[model samples]
Target: MSTLQQLLREIDAKQKRINKQRPLEQTKIKNLKDYFKVGLTYASNALEGSSLTEIETKVVLEDGIAVGGKSLKDHLDAIGHGRAFDWMWELAKGVAISEEDVKKMHVLCFQPSEGEQAGEYRHVNVVITGSQHNDRLPSHEEVPALMNAWAVGLPEKRKNRHPVQYAAQLHQEFIVIHPFADGNGRVARLLLNHALISQGYPPVIISPVFKHEYIQALEQSHTKPENFTAYIAEQALQAQRDYIRLLRIE
Candidate 1:
């Protein structure tokens, strides 16, 4: 078997153990959810240049207080992304993922800063700064049609893939679409976790420390998508380990 296939098998084994503990997750995972809200909020924003430390993010999100000297947008991102993640947690329990779900997540994460443009698709072309092939992104005019087709075909695309691969594909594709004006990365990560969480897998938290490697994988995705997919599987493996640790699954 390929190494990723082997890793996936191990992930499946861990997931089975976690599934056995699912009844207690309603309580046990509740606390972990709050913990991950802070962790995910910190990592996702930091990857995008937010200045809030993890402690600062937790302070802004849970304590309802702003950090001493952070930018207003920084504080807002923590608060807003946390709320969107909350909604995504609820959404994961549902039967399907819809395009509206994607837009709503963008709105929740960006409305505090982006206003009416929150859920709206971009009207002008965007350039993915630092990417080698920015032209690979669809034009703003193409987003609506592309996203519609994507959401419509999601069920079929998800059918044969392993959950981790599906989640990674979801993340990669959403990032490529670059649907909304801002917050695409955050929303894309939300979509990734939504797929994973709904399937009894843990959310993959890409730490800021891995920022360079992560962006490189994403940028290279245009040519070698499996490289990115494998990168995501590695992240999923770590997330699965952390999740099992929190669940005390020995």
Candidate 2:
């Protein structure tokens, strides 16, 4: 078996153990969700260059307080991402991901701040700063068809691939498309977790501290897709461990 296959098996075993403890107490579930929302919001925004610290993100998200000296855009990013995180839970309960649901996540992540472009694909081209791939993203006119095809084909993809690999492919493909005018990374992360959560797996958090390595994996993906797939599987395994620890399950 390949490394990806081994990782998938490990994650599946852990998930089976987790499932036995399902229907976690309301209080425990609430606490875990609250903790992860703050962590995920902070990390996802930070990966995209938001200035809010984890503590500040928690304050801004939980208390609605503006941080001193922080850019208003940063605050909005936190608020918007937090809302999107909540919406992700609702989306998680769905049977499959849809193009409309993906657009709704972009809207939740970028609205008010980017009202005109929120939930909308870019009309102009953009480039990733440090990527070595250099391939042009699908143009504005092409996004609708590309996205529709992606959504329609997801069932077959899920059926053929392990959930971990499927989640990684979902993220990789979405980022490659770079559909929205902005907030694509945040939406992509949300979608990644959406795929995992929909399948009874806990969401993974990609720390900003690993931003360099994360970009490297994404860049290498163009040549060796397994590199990125393995990276995502590792992160999923870490999340499984974290979930087990959080529930104090042996």
Q: TM-score of each candidate? A: 0.97, 0.96
Looking at model 2, residue 194 earns an lDDT score of 91
lDDT of 2 by residue, 1-250 (tens): 9888898899889998999998888898788889999999999999999989999999999998999999999999999999999999877887598898888888988889997888887888777787766565777788888999988989999999988999999999988888887888899999999999889888999999999988899888878888999999999999999988978888
The global Cα lDDT (0 to 1) of model 2 is 0.90
Per-residue lDDT over 26-98 for candidate 1, one digit per residue giving the tens place of the 0 to 100 score: 6666887898899999999999999999989988988898788789999888988998999999999863799
Q: Give me the candidate number with maximum lDDT.
A: 2
Clashing pairs in 1: none
Q: Candidate 1: TM-score?
A: 0.97
